[model samples]
Target: MIPLRAGTVTEVAVLGAHCDDIAIGMGATLLTLARARPGLRVRALVLSGAGTERAEEERRALDAFCPGAELDLTILDLPDGRAPAHWDRIKNALAAFRAGARPDLVFAPQRGDAHQDHRVLAELVPTEFRDHLVLGFEILKWEADTPAPTVFHPLTPELAAEKAQLLLKHYPSQAHRDWFDEQAFTGLTRMRGVQCHAAHAEAFVLDKAVIDFGGS
Candidate 1:
């Protein structure tokens, strides 16, 4: 893999279909970025779970994931698993978010995700953030729809472990789920790390990018 550096990313945007999707998909990466750039601007949007405990869980979870960063989160009350049906609202919300933040990098659900809510949001992201670098993050679930990721963010064992702990700690509502455990999170990170020749890592699908080979 040819290594490409995302130079001086001061702002980032993350989109999720549900409350814990961002943390599940790229918690370690957020941790890495926030530490590297203190007071980094992070804008997050979740389509479901507004006015509920799940939304509260997401607020705490993202704050923990993005330590020391300037984080702004929005949660909506759109029905879960039915994002495609609420296409207009989703599109409008995305447009409003795009107007508010000009992020250097955007973390969003991958297009190939099996979940309908996730897949719909992924499809809508590019329409709003047309000129930005968007990284499609994979969420481990019961479905066999993980994308073949083209980019990898290698993580230290300590960072990976910390991500898992944060996920477990902040989202008590998800603890009952069998897959929402440290072992599963660490296992996926370990496998991705093996693929990328690291001790631990997070993988992402790059839908598109404009590389500057000769720039500073």
Candidate 2:
């Protein structure tokens, strides 16, 4: 596979509709980038679970996922599974976030997500961050919604293992879910790895990209 290199990534923006969505979808990618760019600035926004144990879990989980990077996270009080009703709140929050800083990359959900909340947030992300490289991460749920990703970030076994371990460690609230176990996470990573010819990987969908080959 041909490698597509991104320019120096000093800052990144990660958006999630729920507490563990970011970690489950693109935690390995975050880990890879954070390790590659020490002191990387990560601005993360989650639309729900604010003022609850889930929010706390998200804060601690992101800290661990990003490692030494500067992590700025906001967990909103938006109602769970009801984002479509609060369209203004979601849009305004995204616009405000876009106005604050310019990031090298943005990680968000794809519009094809099965969950209503995730699909709405995904639809709103591009409206604010136009002209930015947006990589849509996928969440493996019981719903038949995972799409074929156009991009892949292969992860080493150790790094993949660490991501699974971190998910299991920081989010005690999610431990009850049957699909939240180590085997499920690792299995998905392994399957993605097979697609990319790596030991493990996290895949993402690129809705749009502008490649420059000026010298050619």
Candidate 3:
């Protein structure tokens, strides 16, 4: 693999359909970035779980994941599993978010995600952030809908382990879910790591990119 670098990423935006989605999808990458670039700006948005314990969990979780970063998070109260029904609201929210920040990188769900809410946000993200580099993060679930990712962010074993621990630690409400466990998180990262020649890593689907090969 010829590694591509997103040089000097000072700001990042992460979007999710649910409270824990961002953590589940790209927690390790957030950790890696925040540590590397202290005071990196992180703007996060979640479509559901506002005004509830889930939102609180999400806030604490993001704080842990994005250490030493400027983090702004917004969580809406849209009903879970019913995002498609509220298309306009979601789209407007995304538009407002887009107007607020021009992030160096955006992390969102892929278009082919099995979950309805995730798929909706994935479809709308590009409509607003038209000219940005969006890396679609994957959430593993009971459904068999994971994609063959076009990019991989390799993580060290320590960071991978820390990510798993943080997930388990920060999101206590998600602990009941069968798929939300250390083994599952570690196993997925390990598998992706093997694919990218690393001990552990997170994968992302790149639907579009404008590469600049510098030379003269």
Q: Which residue segments of model 2 deviate by more than 4 Å?
A: none
Cα lDDT over the full model 1: 0.94
Residue 120 alpha-carbon offset, candidate 1, angstroms: 0.3
> Between which residue pairs do clashes occur in model 3?
none
Candidate 2 vs candidate 3, lDDT winner: 3
Residue-level lDDT tens digits of model 1 in 78-177:
9988998999999999999999998999999999999999999999999999999999999998898978999999999999999999999999998889
> What's the best-to-worst order under lDDT?
3, 1, 2
Q: What tens digits encode model 2's per-residue C-alpha lDDT throughout 46-157?
A: 9999999998889889998998999999889998899999999999999999998689999999889999999999999999999899999999788889799999999999
Clash counts for all predictions? 0, 0, 0
Score each candidate by Cα lDDT.
0.94, 0.92, 0.95
Model 3 / residue 11 / CA error / Å? 0.5
Q: Write the per-residue lDDT of candidate 3 for residues 1-216, one digit (tens) a residue.
A: 889878899999999999989999999999999999999999999999999999999999999999999999999999999999999999999999988987999999999999999999999999998899999999988899989998999999898999999999988988888998999999999999999999999999999998776865
Error of 2 at 135 (Å): 0.1
